[model samples]
Target: MTAYVGKRLAQAVLVLWAAYTLSFVLLSALPGDSVHNRIANPEAQISPEEAKVMLAYYGLDRPLAEQYLHALGGVFRGEFGYSLSSGDSVGHLITSALPSTLQLTGLGLVFGVLFAGVVAVLINYGRWRWLRSLVTAVPSLFASVPTFVVGIVALQYLSFRLRLIPSVDDGTVRALIAPAATLGLVVAAPLAQVLATSMRATRRQPFVHVLQAKGAGEGYIFRQDVLRNSSLPVLTLLGLAVGELIAGSVVTESVYARAGIGQLTVSAVNTQDLPVVQGVVLLSTAAYVVVNLVVDLVYPLVDPRILVEGRSRRSARWRTDGQAVESAADLPAGSARRLPAEVAMP
Candidate 1:
């Protein structure tokens, strides 16, 4: 267990390191510096000398290697630097926007999982192959509909046309419903598809057949035996869904005019705010790593066979001397050193 945990932590560190390095490299590769965007405005008519000064001020004149090293050093020293466009600390901006993003991600995941599970159960209960195909087809079709389209359509129908919620600037939980539902539906689609497939596969497992033969009800076998065994693949899919949620929210945030990290990221990129962009990239990467790590840890618990195998292998290794040690429970009852009655007789 210690070894497994240590290995996962090490992998997480490496993932974050790679994220930072890649963000730095990509930001460096974008043509032109931040200063150019400001001085290049034809209406502003800023002189060449002023542009040069602005460039130097922002350290654009420094070698790329030095700039990257300086930025990295700042990160290590707990200074994320300021956005070139907004004149705000990148860290501060991220902190302010993080709550909204986390809220969106969390809500979307919880509802998505529940919706998928319910849909899978209903589909299985129906037990009609044609109905299953039609139900399964909904998720695939919904998955194909881009998140942006969903957000827009939800805004149009639910918020505007139906007046189910306020359309603009309501700034209430009620206002969040349309966007969150849209995002959740998009997430639920893939999850439902995966769940349906996994549940069907679990139903065909030999143990499920054994359970059914033993007079277990379909619900009992499915809920007590099959679902637990089949959940690992569902977890892996959920982790991927988390990554998709973050990636897909960029468009969703824009459509909904939400003040989440996705919106911040779009603004940062549009204005060439390298510091803010890098910060957002790092934040998203950390989120992905944490989500995947959680899924990996949950694997052992959902599938106890992993730990059982480990213990079995360890016990085998411990008994390498070839001397059989009889467990006390294996001793004959009523002997001087008789085993406990439960194990010895029963």
Candidate 2:
């Protein structure tokens, strides 16, 4: 366990570093940098001496190698440099804007999980064939609808037509609902799709038939056996969805006129604020890495069998006579464990 955790942490660090380095290189390769763009602006009307000093201050006068090293060092020191347009510390701007984004992300993730769980359960277990078919199609429809479109419709109807909740310039929780729901729906679509598929496959396992013959109701069987067994794939999909969630938050924030990392990202890109842009990139990368790291750690808890993959055959043996092994209690009772558990007893 210690080795696994340490390995995941190391990989996370490597990913973060790679993301930062790539972003810096790409931003540097842009036609003109923030410093030149700012100094060249006719409105600034700066003299040659001031321009020279500005270049020096931003380290544009230094070699690319030196600049990269300096920026990398500053990152190590917890300094994200400065925003070219506002001349404010990039770290400070990110710190200030982080709260709103965090609030939205957290709310979005919670709503997403709830919505996805309901949809997945309904998809696999609905009594009526028509209802099951309809529920199955819902994920596809959700996948087709973009976050911006959802946000627009919600904003117009909820805020303008109905006036049910404040959408603009309202700092309260009421204002958060529209955008967070938009992001949540986006997050829920893929999750529901993956979870439903997993559940469907898991339903075909032989143990489910035995449970049915034993008079286990559908709901009881699903809750007691299928849900837990199938959730490993859902956990994996959830980790991958972090990227989609963040991306959707950007558009959602824009449509709802919410202040957050998304808005900050739009402004930075429009003005070519390289430092702020890089900071956002790094922040998003860190979020993705951290979520996946947590997912990796959770694998063992979900199914200890996960820890068995990609290593030498374990130093363990399965019980020939099953007396309710906690993990495989639902699999079979009074059955000898075969090499792959595929043996059929006559």
- Candidate 1 vs. truth: CA RMSD? 7.9
Name the lDDT of candidate 2.
0.86
- Regions more than 4 Å wrong, model 1: 40-53, 127-130, 308-346
Per-residue accuracy of model 1 over 1-346 as CA lDDT, tens digit each: 7777788999999998899999899888888656777788888789999888877777778899998898888888878888888677888999998888777777777778888887887677667888876776777777788888888888898877898877763578887766777778767887887787788888998888888888999878877977887788789988788778898677767887888898998988888888898888888888889999998888898886776666554453211134333554444455344223333322
Question: Pick by TM-score: which candidate is best?
Answer: 2
Per-residue lDDT over 116-217 for candidate 2, one digit per residue giving the tens place of the 0 to 100 score: 999998988888999998998888888899888888899889999999878684789999987887899987988898889999999999999999999999
Superposed Cα deviation of residue 102, candidate 2 (Å): 1.0
RMSD of each: 7.9, 7.3
What does candidate 1 score on TM? 0.84
TM-score on alpha carbons, each prediction: 0.84, 0.89
